[model samples]
Target: MKHLFSLLTILFLLSCASKAQNSSKEKKTYKVEKTNAEWKELLSPMAYYVLREAGTERPFTSDLNKNYKKGIYVCAACKTPLYKSEHKYDSGSGWPSFDRAVKGNVELDVDYKIGYARTELKCNTCGGHLGHSFDDGPKTTGKRHCINGVALEFIPKEK
Candidate 1:
């Protein structure tokens, strides 16, 4: 039975090492780093929650959901231009939806927060959480970038 015990111990150690490696890979390093205090000072309470803590805003509550004026939607944390106004759509999912993001401006990650895998979208500049993207979208892209409205600041196009 000594050989069986040895093999079991080896397997346990291997599993532990694999888990550590996976956890390390999951830690994200952002280009824009800020302390909690700095983020609190720079953002509204809701914005801080959604951007920093990956909290979701209440749906249909954001004025941006209905806003269709021509302009760019920028990251509330960093003012990086993210989504063009033309990509915005009424997904009726309560949150603002976009068909796509500006190239190289958004990062997609896998999220298993709800016991299933989801595509979590973040700002490439600040690494701030924007929302989730799904396969169910318009024919143009077939990808719904369901974004938290509180995480964005709209800059209307000048007349």
Candidate 2:
């Protein structure tokens, strides 16, 4: 009976330690860091508007929405893989939509711009604004990750 109690205590300690470690590894708030000159040189005006300034792109404007190849979609500002092509789907909203983000990647914040509540998506590492999330999406996840085109860069899978 005493040995069983000791084993239980050991397991409890190990579980607590793991929980603390995992919490520490979670992503935190981030801020953008780039000079205007560098941003201008690296991104077009529209891309800059949406990515750096948190402006929204008009619906159905991104070519990536129609993309069907297998690849990873990355943040255009920080090159962090945000979504997989397998998660992409046609939402007919004029923007690229993903049902989910890459595992252990990306970050989300509560946004209330224009008197409406939304979940703002951003790069976990750089904190660049990606876009908003909505509940109206296809079956499976019921999440519409309405992302701007200029905010992402696609890396097609090698054949």
Candidate 3:
């Protein structure tokens, strides 16, 4: 009976130790935890409105849309790399347009808001609302991914 008790106690202690070790070794993922007021302070009014509240910036207003430089575009929310410079093109819609997306990066949804049918693009990692895509583009794929400059941060490639 004493030997049986000792074996059970040893097993219980081992189980607890294993659990503690596992928890300690587990990787911790970091998420941005900012209050609305804090976020407003951290970002510009336009960026905060569009990225956090899903507001749309006026068309033909973003300077980045007119940009034709080579660089990688990243998500403004989490800084995750999203689109490539090669994907960019001039669609004359006032927003930065792309023919395709970075592989396995963004989430696309069919948006029917305000009696208009469009494809809404969003950041897959941070869920930041980007903008709508259209079928008018200068590409063989015929996809014009109209993106909001507020939702993206451009990093010009090294010359």
lDDT of 2 by residue, 80-138 (tens): 88999999999888999999999766788888888988899978867777898899988
Better of 1 and 2 by lDDT: 1
Per-residue CA lDDT of model 1 for 1-159, tens digit only, reads 999999999999999999998877656777888889999999999999999999999998999999999999999999999999999999999999999999999999988988999999999989999999999999999999999999999999999
Name the top lDDT candidate: 1
Clashing pairs in 3: none
Off by over 4 Å in 2: 1-32
Regions of model 1 farther than 4 Å from truth:
1-23
Which candidate has the top score in TM-score?
Answer: 1
Quote model 1's TM-score.
0.87
- C-alpha lDDT (0 to 100) for residue 106 of candidate 2: 74
TM-score of each: 0.87, 0.76, 0.72
RMSD of each: 2.7, 9.6, 9.5
Better of 2 and 3 by TM-score: 2
Error of 1 at 126 (Å): 1.0
In model 2, what are the clashing residue pairs, if there are any?
Answer: 60-94
